[model samples]
Target: MKKEMYAFVVPCSARPLVFDESRCVGCNRCAEVCQVDILIPNPEKGRPPVVLYPGECYYCGSCVMACRQEGAIRLQHPLMNQAKFVPVRHAADAGEEKPLPAEKRRG
Candidate 1:
């Protein structure tokens, strides 16, 4: 049977966490501590964990705390502020969406 599909873009209440691939050691500790289950181990060992559900991220920093590699994973609020309006790519749209300022973040 032929099938059709549609896609939608979602804006988040708060910024999602960020990962530094260069600093990540693929230990999976961050995935272990994520309360929302957004992170999962990479299929190949010795690779950084993947964001299984970006929308489910709470920016709780549990993953950051669990990381043995300093500066590997961190909250996006501080980084966003310092970066001065970084734009994130959305699959559904050609234009990038700007991240909300830290003061505007709900959670």
Candidate 2:
């Protein structure tokens, strides 16, 4: 009899979801609630679900919300997808009265 080895490749650059092994209960709820079907239940009992298609994840946080265990599952959006906050200067702060559009300006 011969034994075969199987390997699953997960992209290193982007991990849309992360599992906290210590906190995970492996109830498979996360996998069930995934709208994109990117996650699958692990064959081994009491182990975290597998991220079969990390790239296919919608980053919708459904899995995290479905999990009963706190900190068991988390959504990690890629750097490009993360939100950035920019400070905006109001017209008063800038000390400028911007002209309105010609159509909107009063005669």
**Candidate 1 structure quality by residue, lDDT tens digits, 1-107:** 58895333344555476678888889999898889877778878877887767677756778888889998876766444555556764533655455654342222
Worst 10 residues of 2 by lDDT: 98-107
In candidate 1, where is summed lDDT lowest over 10 consecutive residues? 98-107
lDDT of 2 by residue, 1-107 (tens): 58896537466579888899999989999888888887777889999988978878877888888889999988988988789988865665667677874343222
Which pairs clash (backbone N, Cα, C closer than 3 Å) in model 2? none
- List lDDT for all candidates, in order: 0.72, 0.82
Q: How high is each candidate's TM-score?
A: 0.56, 0.69
Among these predicted structures, which one has the highest TM-score? 2
C-alpha lDDT (0 to 100) for residue 21 of candidate 2: 92
Root-mean-square deviation of every model: 16.2, 5.1
What value does the lDDT take at residue 58 in candidate 1? 59
Model 1 RMSD to the real structure? 16.2
